[model samples]
Target: MLHVTTYYDTLKVTRDAPAIVIQAACRALMQLNHPDNFEGREYEAVKIAEDLREAFDVLIDPNTRAQYDNWLAKQMEQSN
Candidate 1:
């Protein structure tokens, strides 16, 4: 089985996490992966930060989040 990465996983939050929890998770992840914190791996850190930002963008909005949630549910069902 292929393990697909979801926005919830990117933010390190549960699928049913609240908006505030998602927000906090995104902030914490970005801070942890900040380019300034990794001198040698700065490029890797930037890429990770970009992914986190994308996850945050989708999960932060109500309409998009609902759409994503539906899509994620189908993905899970297929994976099973």
Candidate 2:
């Protein structure tokens, strides 16, 4: 499984950021990286857009977010 930190970074947010912040970050990332944002790099743009959607999906769901948060805390504990 991908680390929660990895997911948070995918959405460009801090681990402790609130759900609303996560949602806002996801929206910002989508708007910035959306396929339409890259007029020339269509292929790369599509890939970015897909990644954005996946990140948003995982972070936006409460259950998944809780799981991610738990995993993240565990990782941090292990790291220290």
Candidate 3:
């Protein structure tokens, strides 16, 4: 599963970042990781692109983002 922590890092945004920030991050990352940009590195690029898409998929949806934020909080709590 794609972790919320990964998404935050990929987007270079804090956990409390707004929806617009998430969307902008996804757009920027997708531009760099898009299949067409990979060329010979299709396999690796595809995987990265998929991860970016999954992150956007969750973060773009308010409910899913909320759930992920909660999950991330719990994960941090346990780690601490």
Query: Of the candidates shown, which would achieve the greatest TM-score relative to the real structure?
Result: 1
Sort by lDDT, top down from the best: 1, 3, 2
| C-alpha lDDT of all candidate models, in order | 0.92, 0.80, 0.81
Where model 2 places Cα greater than 4 Å from the true spot, the runs are: 1-5, 71-80
Predicted structure with the largest lDDT when compared to the true one: 1
> What does the lDDT read for residue 40 in candidate 3?
90
Select the stronger candidate by TM-score from 2 and 3.
3
What TM-score, to 2 decimals, does candidate 3 have? 0.81
Question: In model 3, where do residues sit more than 4 Å from their true spots?
Answer: 1-5
Poorly placed runs, candidate 1 (over 4 Å): none
TM-score: model 2 vs. ground truth = 0.71
Better by lDDT, candidate 3 or 1: 1
Candidate 1 lDDT by residue in tens digits, 1-80: 89889998999999889999999999998888888899998899989989999999999999999999899889889889
Tell me the RMSD of model 1 versus the true structure.
Answer: 1.3
Evaluate model 2: give its lDDT.
0.80
